[model samples]
Target: MNKVKVLVCGDVEGKFQTLFSRVENINKGHGVFDLLLCVGNFFGDTDEGLEPYRNGKLTVPIPTYILGPCSAVQVALYPHISGCELCPNLTYLGKRGLFTSSSGLKLAYVSGIEAESDTLSHHTFTDKDIESVKNACLRGQTNFRGVDILITSSWPKDIMLGDKGCSVQIEPNGSWLLSWLAAQVKPHYHFSGQEGVYFERAPYRNHSFSGSTPEHATRFIALAKVGNTLKHKWLYAFSLAPIDQMSTTHLYQETTDQTDCPYTGKMLHPSLSMKQVRPSQFFYDMDSLTDEGNQRKKARKDNKQQHKRQPPKFDQESCWFCLASATVEKHLVISVGSESYLALAKGGMVPDHVLILPVGHHQSLSTLPDAVEEEIEKYPLRTSALKKYFKKQHKVPVFFERNYKTSHLQIQTVPIPHNMAGRLKRVFQENAEQDGLQLDELPHHTKLSQVAPPRTPYFYVELPSGDKLYHRVANNFPLQFGREVLASEELLDMADRADWRDCKATKEKETELAKAFRCAFEPFDFTL
Candidate 1:
């Protein structure tokens, strides 16, 4: 119930008196607001406009945070390259990183604009700037349930994705970097400027969210430059109860204006300049598929077979999920086998959502040693220890695996309420049909080897009815499609809980969870 009041403004353009005067009046009317955020061009064409604050002639009213300057002249005004307080109550958020408030409001920001080249300057942000924000979400040290807010200088392209009634006056010439960043961070709210337009898109569900749509949908707002002659509204105000503090009912309440996500495929996120995109390291790997590359591949598919793409080299030392890696969340590991191990999934979709991983560096189920595959599928109960582990808790196991764009193989097993078993196939089928995909049902108790040969890129789901469904991923497959179906209204109805990154518990809580599972799954632990 920790509610924090926030006020956000568009480009200030160095109109100190006009912006602060309005802010002071609002503070007088509302008495006290927790913080103020300024986005876009904070400085204008002259140093004279900023001199009031430098000379103590103007005050910042509330705790104000601003992105780095937009022009070369403004850059000279900023003394600290790593972010620091310019004066009392005003702080610069630096080049890029995650900023957490005392009230537990997490804000991820990329300052300035998208850099065109590999330049090391604040006027524009490059791939490393955006990647730093992604790397900031590293787990194990602390638990995160997504950021409360995200700030950027420019609106993400197609920011009006789900908003059908988008105004013609406001053309969204935003950044693909911001679009890609928005999809990954999944912040509750996002604010930007730079187009000099005041428009708020209808709350749209982030790519990984489905069931409790309103709880996790991101509200994107772009405020106009302050004191523009056209009289566009450049200020917005809202109150937020941090995600970690809200109760389930309050957080998941459905909103009437929700829309499907606008970001999908490479058209929404065309590749920018980068040395390489390591699809193996990230979960939603789409960098490999450029708009041009996809078209060429499709054209070749019609004429003749396109040569198989050589899989990217797997880097074990930096792998986050590897048990021996320095970055692995060791607290989540439960049971270890010679060939395979059971670990509590980080940011799991459910309390019992777990991962079945090979101890060695196997990239997919097709590449596993025959003996190891046999042990995984044909243990003591003629089933997996994963299946037995969930059954002890009176939940049916729903196992899924993706081989499209990953370096390490992980079989995600999420437990379902016992009664929900019968509804699984129908729901999965309906979702696939909606996506124009047909799920090929394998024969009863079909083995993985029968459906997928060595090094085949496929995604398959094993339902609780002992029935299996498979999808051969040729091109443009949705990364979180399985999660979308499972968390849809017909099945678990946990759309809000679809993304694993939003479901992580505390480290101490995770340790206790592993210990409990290790005890209950002992009988099924063939490793023991």
Candidate 2:
């Protein structure tokens, strides 16, 4: 088998070890992964740390990509784009987007970069920069209005090195080159699940993982650092391999009797240890319930009444599925209307599928009643069945995918294999924990958005012509505890017509930000 080499590096306090163990489990499950490597940072920057993985104790060679900072494994994995050809942006990594964790709380550390050069200059990427990236990820966001790409271009402000300066120190005793290379060498393993302390499967198949438990903290990994030097700086990379890859192919599924566990059925009890458990409940209170429930109920009732009053006229704009039936054909390409969007289809096939949409906009399945939900679900199946009957008689997959905070209609391309679509769904569902699923439900009322009580209260005034002017509310008004809403129409109260008191301040702030972004993009015409 062609082996997959994963190199991981970052800050010491970050979850490198946990990532290693999880990758190991994935390798065991799929039996196609080889070598595990971890770069230094065991103690982070503290004076009291030791090398965790040392030379000669490793099972195989794996590379590590190093960086100055580290967040949790979920934030780390968020950078990866799947190798599947269906990836919409496989040709290029899109502009860096904000990455928030499942929680509404913005992490204080996450930063996102929008331009290519932004990843290169230390002046642009400071400790504060890293913090911004971490904050974005912690808030369960992947992209912001202006930010689309995420990466580390330069070291912290304390590091002194330049891209051109790196070439001069390539010879012997090149400490600068080694140090700089070391930062770039931190190769993170990007799996679909949470970090674990041990391995149970391979990268080619599903696997279970666990985090470091109190019982395993004392356990140490053997590691050795290799260095390269560039002029005036040190660039280095480290190598670490799992010491136990050969022992069991089944990982946590290993039974006391020493047999490989089946990948499916009763035998597959996720050997995930207790420490890796994540919360899996949805909590809501009366205020939110009242707001959401009433709106959804009203929409549904209106939809039903409209259908009864009309002669069953099909409106493609309201529902994507209806749109597909109205405007699409048997074997053509299809795309949804979500932001950060792309169209998808099978290789060498004509794009002939149309995505189905509801007669009215509904953000998620949870917002729909049982009947509407069922109708929505039928969109995929019906598309697949129709395509099979009229075209190749092949069962194509229907993906139910969407991004958070996007009003753009979610797109769905048809004529793709149902199995592949199913696989994608499984991949998402199975890896939900690792992907930090369900963490963004804090609702805007949370304390995370407490910006020193608004300096000016919002106001409203009526003009002689009966026109109303309103003061802008805070940009980020608390939605619920730990949750917030942007000063956007989605959360507006038209009747109140309150003046957006902070509009001028917010506009000035945005202007300043635009200047900064323009400055960052000055040398290069990124608009091209």
Candidate 3:
């Protein structure tokens, strides 16, 4: 059970020493780890002086391997500096195809020559993008120990002109590069060039190493002796979507400051905003008493009166998913079906949202069949996926969901959470396992459905009852519900009182549930 750790490096040489120190410190007696995986960028352009380190010839004690594309051709074509091609370590790593050596250590490569083309100068590289790729690779290694060898593609740096048209250049080196480099050289070691600067500038810049200092270099070396990996562990991927698309795993914002934008405010698609509406009021239609507005206005007034009369906005029937106070947002019936309904409601449509509901008066998931349960589970995740899908497939982000009329179950819909990739990847991996396949070696073109066909609806129901019912109805009632064809009344009845319904309601009651259905709901517990 080798506790395999990966060292992710970028174009830095000095950091490798620090990386070794850190690895030695943490892994002192932990013989569980047998291999050190270097994701790439062990030495930078200036470090051609270390050319002798390549080809299983490095002075480092551990058996080492470096895998990467032989950029000799690219390096010759784009030589920003002299002797970069001769860097023994880079040449050695470039030829190994990013795999393990006969002796067992892993070596990988990043196309530094191509990277040189991407950046302003050979001496400077985007440390952040390099780190991002490295971190992701390291995480991939963490999942499986036998994956002692891993390789990552080169990270391209962007050199764009600012608004003022000044030749502003962004560069990262010293500690930032060193830390990242050291991490790659040795899996453990604290490397930070500009701790505050790295974080503060991260949002605005695409590269990581733009802020490194000599002071940080000294700290990097000292930390290396003590084995200190930087505090700001890099995440391989980040969810650009706001709160709804974000999974619980994301960095949570503590303040409700406007700077947090989508992270904290009401759920909205990334593109749409409240500012688009002129002189927008929070509850405009609800205040008007006209024919159309009267119903909405009366609804709001009734909710207000109820708030004044009752202990809280909703004792039992606030939408648990969206956390919408039915008393607040003016409701819009986006779609209505005999068995399910969609509503667009918001407290203050700072960002409008979508809501989905399995109609016909059901409150619990237990009433759903496995298929329905499955679909319900996919709802929020799919919502998140659709956001990414829309961005990828449609070039736009859309919000979707149906409304559950004044019910305890609030199924508010927004974009999916960001962490869904991990879950979906897991599902795909599991399916591959059943088929005796490996996820890592799987081709990118391999379709997900090919791996895990939508889980077949769990059970058959003579009547619309059980968790399977929701799946059946949600899938457009392709199955028979009762003795005859599917009936809306039967589905509603199933929704209200099925084995799964009790389970779902109980789950909802326990946890202050999120709108996304994919999330687990805690069962309500009484303390008194």
Candidate 4:
């Protein structure tokens, strides 16, 4: 089977003695693991806290990988050193890189946290550091098949969303970029520390880059700080096989009917089915309410009624793109400009596909103010800038816009590989003909408002080579014709991710995409 057992530990917090004892006990009881992966905060909480590790007072029992830039002093003293072997068995994993153990276990890591400023710190990792790692993966140096395990300093943001029995507020401490990277990398297992709570999420599947096939479910685990008496577990262990061993036969054959938590080995349904306690019942004693408390409650009720009587601030309550509405996922927003902003498209047709939209609620380009129209016209430049940033040397930008008359204005930018541009028009035409709808080629300067009457819904696809339009007076036309065409060109099944609402991503994924776009678009942002 060629399986490798791995022991994952949370923040050591300088509890070397306790950590050593725990590993020893685990080894004695459960047999030896191939590797020990420590997440972060390996040293104590203060400067000069790594003396024990540096002075050889503590020993790592197994081949241990510790996430690094150990301390400011160590980093400054050894700037050129990627990682140092603290002892025979202990080695730092460096700031951000990939490493493959002798057992053939490939691991990718992003060490440290996002700092508030540029000031260097032992535990600081920035978006650029993440981008470097991403670029390496894209370059195929890290093995595009995907890493066996991914380690990060903090828990991914919004990982708890849609998870039953979870009510904790996810703080912004975790990196959104890492979350997005996880989705792209599709690692089989992901480990994180620094959330102060031990959590293991249900495994979820992501599309593999190799083809349209879905990869095995990726398990995400967040460990609480070591030695935390309550709500914390010091370590976790799991068995993983080599990449080649992860074949369809083995995966399907080994699958069992049991629905147990992958980490805790408990029944998932039972845990998820636990009833939630009401806030009123859990926090208060109704019998103890005094007359003063009663009066306070009545006063609060009156205030709520008074506020409810006031009208809403914005009229576009139903518009998903409107920032004021709850439907707008703030994490998807890339860059905010004076008149318009950029955002990643949910269930995007291609990777890094983005949307440029005006700040105000406008049904169509014709209704946009002069200032907004001028800003919107600069989208072609922005699209070109994105192509350069992504290093799509042989790809050209394709812009698609829809003025469904009743829908808010948005300009979609997708990078189409040069080879696909020639056949893209034919592909769309054939697909439209299949749907019994005729496709019409339009001039680059042609606007939907001029072709169709006001409040008439229309879709347009614009490329540097030419432009195509589909005027729809009837509601039977496919609203997602552009996405469908692109998906078909890429040989992907559009039925899976055609609707954005059906394929909603976690906040972490959205944040990472937005951050990457924001950085790439920063140099080209005219508003800045």
Give each model a TM-score. Answer: 0.53, 0.27, 0.22, 0.45
**Cα RMSD for candidates in order:** 11.3, 22.6, 23.5, 15.1
Q: Write down the lDDT that model 1 would get.
A: 0.71
Give the residue spans of candidate 1 off by over 4 A.
Answer: 1-153, 156-173, 176-222, 225-232, 235-330, 378-385, 489-497, 500-512
lDDT of 1 at 524: 76
lDDT of 4 by residue, 355-410 (tens): 77887776666567778887777766534455555444567777776654235677
- Tens digit per residue, CA lDDT, model 1, 199-289: 8888886664344433367888889999989988899999998877877676556589888777777533422234432222322221232
Between prediction 1 and prediction 2, the one with superior lDDT is 1
Window of ten residues with lowest summed lDDT in model 1: 282-291
Model 3 score (lDDT):
0.28
User: Candidate 1 vs candidate 3: which has greater TM-score?
Assistant: 1
Cα shift from native, residue 461, model 4 (Å): 34
User: Relative to the unseen true structure, what is the Cα RMSD of model 2?
Assistant: 22.6
Q: Higher lDDT: candidate 1 or 3?
A: 1
Give Cα-based local distance difference scores for all models: 0.71, 0.25, 0.28, 0.62
TM-score of 2: 0.27
Off by over 4 Å in 3: 1-3, 14-16, 44-58, 67-91, 95-110, 113-150, 156-528
The per-residue C-alpha lDDT of model 4 at residue 119 equals 49
